[model samples]
Target: MNTTPLRLLIHGASGRMGQALQRLGSEADSGCDVVAAVSRKVDARVLEGIPQFAASELHGVPEFDVAIDFSLPQAFDAILGLCVARRVALVSGTTGLSDAQKAALDAASVLIPLSWASNFSLGVAVLHTLVERAAQALPGWDCDIVEAHHTRKLDAPSGTALTLGEAAQAGGAAPHYASLRAGDIVGEHLVQFTGMGERIELVHRASNRDIFARGALHAARRLHGRAPGRYRVADLL
Candidate 1:
C-alpha cells in the first residue's frame, strides 16, 4: 500500500457534513490528513492546527492533493475552479446543482479526477447494487423508492432516492419515488419490489450523517491516483 499521507482540503467546514468530516478526519487512516478547511464561518479550532480560510481565501492558498465538498450549490462553481486550477481530485457530496453547474463539473472532470455522489454511505451503495440486480432479475417488478430526511432539507425526492431510482432503471426496472422530510430523520431509503404473488423490500437507513462523511473520506483516498474522469461510489467500490 502507498505510505504517503494524502493532504486534504474541506470546502464546507461550517455545515453539519463539514463537522462530521472534521471529526472523521481526526481519526482517519494514517494515510490521510485534512490540511485545510475553507468556509464562510468556521471555528478557528476546528482546523485542528491547520489553517482555516474564508471562502474567498481559497485563491491565495496553495494546492491540496484532494478535497471533499459538502457545501451549498452556490459554492460549487468556485470550488470547481479552485480544484481544477490546483489539479486536485475532488469528492463532492453537494446536492441541488443546476444543469449548468453539472455541465461545468463534467467539463472540469476532463482536467482532473472527480467523484460525485448524492449519497456516500456504503450501505446506500450496496443497496443500489441490490436494487440493480433485483431490477434485472425481475423486469416485470413494480418498484417504488421512499426516502425520509431531516425537515430542514429543501429538495424533495432526496438525491439519494433519485440515485436509487436510476440504479433500479439501470438494472431494468421502472421506479416511482417519494420523499418525506420530517423530524430529525437522518435518512431512510426503502425500495419495494412487487411481483406476481409477492413483494420484496430492501431498506437502508442511516441514523447519523457520519456514515456519509466516512464514505466521502474513503472515496477521497481511492480517487487520489485515478485518471481524470467523472466517477460514482459504485466505481470506487
Candidate 2:
C-alpha cells in the first residue's frame, strides 16, 4: 500500500464543506496534504502553511494529485478545466449544475479521473446500495422515495434522492419521489417498498455536514493514481 500522503487542492475554501475539509485535512493522520486553497476572495496569502489563492489565481497554484470541490455551479467549470489541463484527479460535490455542465463533465471524464456527486456522505452511498437491493428483492412492489432537507436547500427531491431513484430503476423498479424542505433538517431520506399488507422502509438521516467533507477527503485519497473515469462515492467505498 502507498504510505505517501496524497497532495490536495481545495477548491471552494470559504464554504461550509470547504472549511470542514480544511480543518479535517489538517489532522496528522488524514493521509493527505492540502497544498493550495482557492476561494472567490482571499484575505490571506497563506494560512497554516497552506498557500491560499483567490479564484483568479487558480492558474498560479502548485501541482497537486487531486482537487476536492464543493463550490457553486458557476465556479465549477474553471477548476474542472484546470484539473483536466493538469492531468490530475478531481472529486467534486458541487450541485445545481445545468445539462451542459454535466455533459462537459462526461466529456472530461474520458481525459482525467473525476467524480462529481450531489452529496458525499458514505451513509448515503450505502443507502443507495440498499435501495437497489430492496428493489431487486421485491419485484412488482410500489417504491416511493421521500427526501427532506433544510429549507435553505433549493432543489426539490434532493440530488441524493434522485440518485437513489436511479439505483432503484437499475433494479427494475419505478420510483416516485416526494420532497420536503423544513427548518434546519440536515438531510433525511426514506425509501419505502409497499406490498399488499406489509411494507419495508429504509431510512438514512444525516445530522452533520462534516460527513460530506470527510467522505470527499476519503474519496480523494482513493481516487489518486487511478484509471481515468467517472466514479461514485460507493465505488470508492
Question: Could you say which candidate leads in lDDT?
Answer: 2
User: How high is the lDDT of residue 48 in model 1?
Assistant: 65
Estimate every model's Cα lDDT from 0 to 1.
Answer: 0.87, 0.91
Error of 1 at 212 (Å): 1.3
For model 1 the TM-score comes to 0.91
Query: After aligning candidate 2 to the native by TM-score, how far in Å is the CA of 51 from where it should be?
Result: 2.7
- Distance from true position, residue 167, model 1, in Å? 1.0
Q: Give the alpha carbon lDDT tens digit for every residue of 125-237 in model 1.
A: 88988999999998888999999999988887888899889999999898998889899999999999998899999999899898899889889989998999998898886
Off by over 4 Å in 1: 28-30, 43-47
Screening candidate 2 with a backbone cut-off below 3 angstroms (N, C-alpha, C), the clashing residue pairs are: none
TM-score of each: 0.91, 0.91
- Write down the worst ten-residue block by lDDT for model 1: 41-50
Q: Give the worst 10-residue stretch by lDDT in candidate 2.
A: 151-160
